[model samples]
Target: MDEKTGEVLGRVVVTQRVGWCADLVSTMARSLISEHWNTSDVGMLASGEDAEGRALPSNAWMALRRLGWGASAPEGVKVNDRIVRMAQEQAGRTLRSAQWRAELTTGVLTSWPADPAKRTADEWVNVRAAVPGGQHLPSSVIKSRTQQIASFARANGRVPADPFELEGAPGVARMLLLSACDGQQATIECREDDPSRVVLRLQLPVRPDPR
Candidate 1:
């Protein structure tokens, strides 16, 4: 095949699909001709070895180098399909590796979304684990913490103002309060709206160290 014109030359038969052949030809043309070809010239010269008899202008020669000889022209024109295929394959591999690296950095394990929300399965797992009683944390620990909070509220005869009302009890609310408190006084206030629900509010001093 001729890289410039993408025309098969001589009797060298190839079993590859025509599209593959075109890809091969295009690769070779980009590498060998596109960089050097002149854009202004539009004419092609007849294929012959007699430079003096059929010498093309410098600009025409550049275009001709990119175009190769036309389909009806004679033999001896050459194209390296092996090199073309190798270059195309290498380019494909490089692109795939780049995509893989991007996915790895973003924590996308698989291409398909496991949930209807279009999030990956691993992402859903992490989100669930972050929740108070999700599988990511021990169920016993979560239950015990909740029970401690209920007991403390019952004993105080008033719901503790904030999640820290349970004192040392380690629950999601306690974790949040601890993280927000910086060795300063914090207040938790609770208002009972009904038997089933209670509204809780927290107040902390503006200064980092209220002491």
Candidate 2:
């Protein structure tokens, strides 16, 4: 189950319909961890614990627009849904008040369903924000789920390391930019792309060591 990708989940996340379920699950998990959830219906998340036998929350379909969880794509930063879920789950628990950046992100919607009400049926976007009081992402930051990062590193043949101890995307970027070898070197560049956006670039020399 670990090595084989989450097929049903993958289809759900990459598509529109089932994405809200993931968000709800992620949100519920975070709330439990954060001790902020107010509903007694949390048992809905228990394994085989369907109290109402309903697939998910009635408002899940309205998650993005209703909640303003998404914004137009090119106008916003791109992100991965997988990490967004982790961000939600990690939120106030693993992540403290000062852990993430001040700014929050919403999904970058590239396409829309013909029927707005059918939004939950199938949609795609980059993760950027969360529920009213859910986790705020790290600043100038992005976070990746362990599975996503590990799988990519395995295929690429190098595991990154960071001396900065920065968390989320910046941390990953730092690790990737630095070399395991004593003298190996890399270059990183940062610049403002626009009034609201910034760009970060990393250049590393190819190395024989796969660390």
How much lDDT does each candidate structure score?
Answer: 0.33, 0.28
Candidate 1 lDDT tens digits, 97-167: 23322222122212213332344667656534544345555535434444554566468874444332233
lDDT of 2 by residue, 1-211 (tens): 1123433334433343234333433443343333422122122232122344544322222221222223111223333343233333333222222222211211211122243223332331223333122235432233332233344446666432321112232211001112211221223344556546543222211221112
Q: How many angstroms is residue 166 displaced in model 1 relative to the true structure, after the best TM-score fit?
A: 2.0
Q: Pick by lDDT: which candidate is best?
A: 1
Model 2 misplacement above 4 A? 1-36, 46-48, 51-78, 88-211
Provide the lowest-lDDT 10-residue window in model 1: 169-178
Taking every candidate in turn, the Cα RMSD to the unseen true structure, in Å, is: 37.1, 24.2
TM-score of each: 0.18, 0.17
lDDT of residue 72 for candidate 1: 15
Model 1, C-alpha of 14: deviation from truth (Å):
90
